[model samples]
Target: MRFLAGLFALLAAFFPGAAPAQVVDGAVPGRAAAASVTDPENILVLDLSTGGRVRIWLRPDVAPKMVERVKTLARQRFYDGLAFHRVIDGFMAQGGDPKGDGTGGSPLPDLPAEFNYLPHVRGAVSAARAEAENSANSQFFIVFQPRFALDKKYTVFGRVIDGMQYVDAIERGEPPASPSRILRAYVLADNPPPYVAQPSLPLPAPASTLLPLPTGPAAATPKSAPSPKPVRRAARKATRR
Candidate 1:
């Protein structure tokens, strides 16, 4: 049985969150309900182009301001049709940039950093910012694997408790050639419309102009093209010494 044990270990390393848990119709089973969110206001729902819905339990206790920002944007329907602009396999999927080019945010003011003790485990939802910590605005990302090193570095405001399988299906690329999108976003308390599959539409070319960081936060350095070095470093830390 040594061979079988070794195979299982390999699988566990590659799919750390793949423990067999019951899922029904893309929702986590009731057994996880004890830890799952029930309060409608604390839940953020995304109807994704990858198909089906993703339910996130917002953590106001640790990151109240970030939670409030996300809820406010969702109520405005600001996230609908926004591309999953930056998706790295085995890392995370980032979107909510109106530019669809990793360089945009809502007209709303940038938020102060809400960094907390939350670990960046699989399905953790965190806000994305430029070099400046307090520059996070409408952009956010969802972790595909555990990334503990990012715990206190980014503002993690939520965790996905359901429909993660759909999240796993998001196309992988810095900007996916055919990027998945948020068809709709809702605060569960609002009684938003049911999920309806949207027809595929061509995304407009991204604009070259980058908006200056909002007035309150420290000036943000312009974001350069994404590099693989950070992902490589994170992988080595997770796998090697």
Candidate 2:
């Protein structure tokens, strides 16, 4: 019993060149199928660290700067598996923490604020900030109401297209009593590039970076950072939106 809105239709639109869907209501396909996206309208296909998935619609016309920042961070897996450290019952739940605290953000530097005139309505995506204007990095929350006062002060970027019930179902608190894990967060290119580019980062040379010769003590283990596996960038199929 999930309530859906026009945002769902927007999702269908952003990812273009699609066939007609016999969608009933707005229940999206299962998460795994959702992960294997082929639509270009898809902006953020979240593989939440909690095993739940969410898809967000990016309005290039509305929050262009914000969308660019989000895509870069997502490609880097910046918010992966972080905790939603803050929640206000009846207000909204917040996450995107790397240290599992309200303060922790991405390894990258903070993003200058990009406040637009968008209203803070239900399912609205806006950046969370401290006392300053341009202090946002990787923190945002969805508004469940129209916060008019936040109109020009916060960057109202995107909106929840579907799976809001999942967002609503998350346990709430300044920090939940138990860890509110994100499980794994990742973004699939709504439109994957036609060809796989060689990994831009050069791989370490074979012998030096490879299996130790077993000659000296065990080689130091390198940190294994989880990365997003590249999928074919989806084309903008014909949309029902």
Candidate 3:
């Protein structure tokens, strides 16, 4: 376990502009220490449809507005039953869209970019946005492999501190024929309700029903990238919009 931890530390050391807040001494890789969460309010807990709970340590220090947006949505139970609409093997799982299609976001206004020094290492949670840097709303994704190319290009508001195995278990596809989902999301400080298995919602509306894509110099049709390698390669490209 220490070997795995040391490898992550080394990766951080070699990666330019990696955030220092999460690289703690004696930290285990994949399974971050639960005690690392000093403030429960900063912990975002997801009870996944895949079964088991995943805890992400929200980093307001680097991406305050993005974190606030996430917390606000969770408090509203806005994420309950949302499908992991886009999951790429060895890449990331993208979700939090109300329309269950990549083009949708919450009714809330879009937020300006809060890009920071946080590296897109495994377990990193970043906001999904349109080409316009300020277009991120309720959509976000969790990194399953280190994606250095994504660093500073996306707003990383949190990192999975535990239950990554469950994240790893998320079904893989642009839209998995049997996609996994978030049963519920909560701010740990609020003592949200426990997980209970719920019947799946009808499959997401077909692509033909997708909302109009955002329009601007930054806008592009949202599409899931192809599968990527485990390390040091420019993984498949996706708009994450």
Candidate 4:
């Protein structure tokens, strides 16, 4: 239990938002939702193109920089129409790329890592960065499964307080064949502008781009073989004789 005590102290010092509650009679305390009942401003509303609505609660106490970055971008309408370019089924849904491919972000400079001890439990929201520790820009992901390995690695700044179903339903693929997108996103505290669905990117060419096959009976009928040239009448008569 000494290890647990030290771990709790470490977490409390750096991640006040996720300080583990004291275990009482083998039962854990209630969720943060119960504690956040009076603080609706911390919740963000994300509306997707498929008419799905998601509510996520920000945790500035644990990842102040990341939470601020996200709120800044959301208020500017930066995530509107951005595709979930990288989604792994049973794992996560990632987005915030302006390119709709996983390669773009806002013109703003990248943010320094704000790695925290927040647990990557299902519905946890964290920044998406490249190999470099401080490369996180506008991209972020929402986990659909517990990912303890990600703890203390990614910047966990929020958790989905509502609409996990929508997050679960987001299209899945490294780059989903038909990726879903954020129709609009806004911080509940910022008096976010009204959401307007953005146009979807042009679809890829069909798997088989071959021209449509000719239809109707005329196309089906094989032309009769050209009539054999009439054998010379003289040759025919000689053979008969």
Candidate 5:
């Protein structure tokens, strides 16, 4: 017991980012710790074929249509056992194409453009496309820093709700010498108890965000002042007489 405790302590101390499993199993020193992943969808696990597993929390509200597309592809094993062929340090780590080229796409039909004005902030999950904006299929990339160049251009749908450091730990470049891969990619909120719907009225416009209409209500004007009443003068002349 004392030896095991000492071992655990050493692993936790030296391998600060190493998960407990990695600690015991002799993983890299500065890798990310593993944790149980739970999202509103379902428990989606991302096991790296090279080593270790991670949890992903997908956002459906942000890109409902895209999320549905990804889930559909995952169900059909579109990304099963696929490799993270392209990995760039201090920039982004991309994958999900079966062809293993930065260029391959899914067998399914192409997706329509869902570009929004959202920023390409760090940890942002966005669709990978070709020359066309509406060409996003199954390939995607996770940004590690603000990619302003991608803003207003790419379709940003999700983010790294958890397990980002693990992604950073992966080896870089196509066919990484270490061969990092996502053993599986699954949905989290496949089927949950649906939210109860209650009738609600439209929200009032916020003054700050309200855009002045080209022609709405007329500009308010001050009302005309009523005519001043005539001042009555004292009638003391009769008294004087």
Candidate 6:
């Protein structure tokens, strides 16, 4: 093992910009100098029904085919309304199963695993597949914590850059009592409105306690100073006091 480590270190020293080999089950090859998505335009935004949003910047360099698949699916609005069917706190939040039962995917064919050296660190977005190595499809999962065991096992195509707090707050359950959903999804490159999840207004207090809507012009009219009472000439009475 020491010899192998030394060999890897030597290779890295020879190759500029090479990622250091991570010592997992064994010394795995490091990330190569490949083009990655360094712009915000390659991001995917998930507007959740829970009023939370997560932004993930896609890494085309690590998994080009998978990233393209994700972009195509997002453009088709394929992920909208999908429930996080399988969520394990401290692990990951899995979704994109159209069936919402962890047993479905896009009608399109499955993806061959694009496993790379990308580590499954917090907020890593990876493809979820069946028992088969090449069964990955539309379904994917977002890591909430570092999971080195999953490194190179799943296709790591993206990572959460903003709104990871929301991902961390995802309901924890294999199938949450009420699964949160992707209310809508779109590519950031499309220049979509930035998602800002705000707390729902307190149900308008209770209709009974709420003020009634003003009627007609009364609602539209702006208030003004009352007219002066014509300087009520103190009734010049008092017989010219």
Which candidate number maximizes TM-score?
3
* Pairs in steric clash, model 6: none
lDDT of 4 by residue, 1-241 (tens): 9999899899899999997577775445662322252365677789876556788988876677777787888888888767776675656677777665545557787778888767878999988765456767787888877766666666888899887887888877656788788888887766655655555554222111010111342121111222323422211111110
Per-residue lDDT of model 5, residues 141-160, tens digit only: 77766666666666777767
Which candidate would rank higher by TM-score, 3 or 4?
3
Give the better candidate number (2 or 6) by TM-score: 6
Model 2 lDDT tens row, 75-137: 776765555665555555666655454444555666666776567677887776544566666
CA lDDT, candidate 6, residue 119: 85
- For candidate 4, the 10 contiguous residues with the lowest summed lDDT are 205-214
- TM-score of each predicted structure versus truth: 0.71, 0.58, 0.72, 0.66, 0.58, 0.68
lDDT (Cα atoms) of all candidates against the true structure = 0.74, 0.51, 0.74, 0.65, 0.55, 0.66
Provide backbone clash counts, one per model.
Answer: 0, 20, 0, 0, 4, 0
lDDT of 1 by residue, 6-100 (tens): 88788878998765665775555543222237889999999999889999999887788888989999999999898887776777788887777
Q: Which stretches of candidate 2 lie above 4 Å from their native place?
A: 1-42, 49-51, 190-241
RMSD of each: 12.6, 19.9, 10.7, 22.1, 26.6, 25.3
Error of 6 at 19 (Å): 12
Compared with the true structure, the alpha-carbon lDDT of candidate 6 equals 0.66
Global fold similarity of model 5 (TM-score)? 0.58
User: Residue 20 deviation, candidate 4, in Å?
Assistant: 9.7
What is the model-wide C-alpha lDDT for candidate 3?
0.74
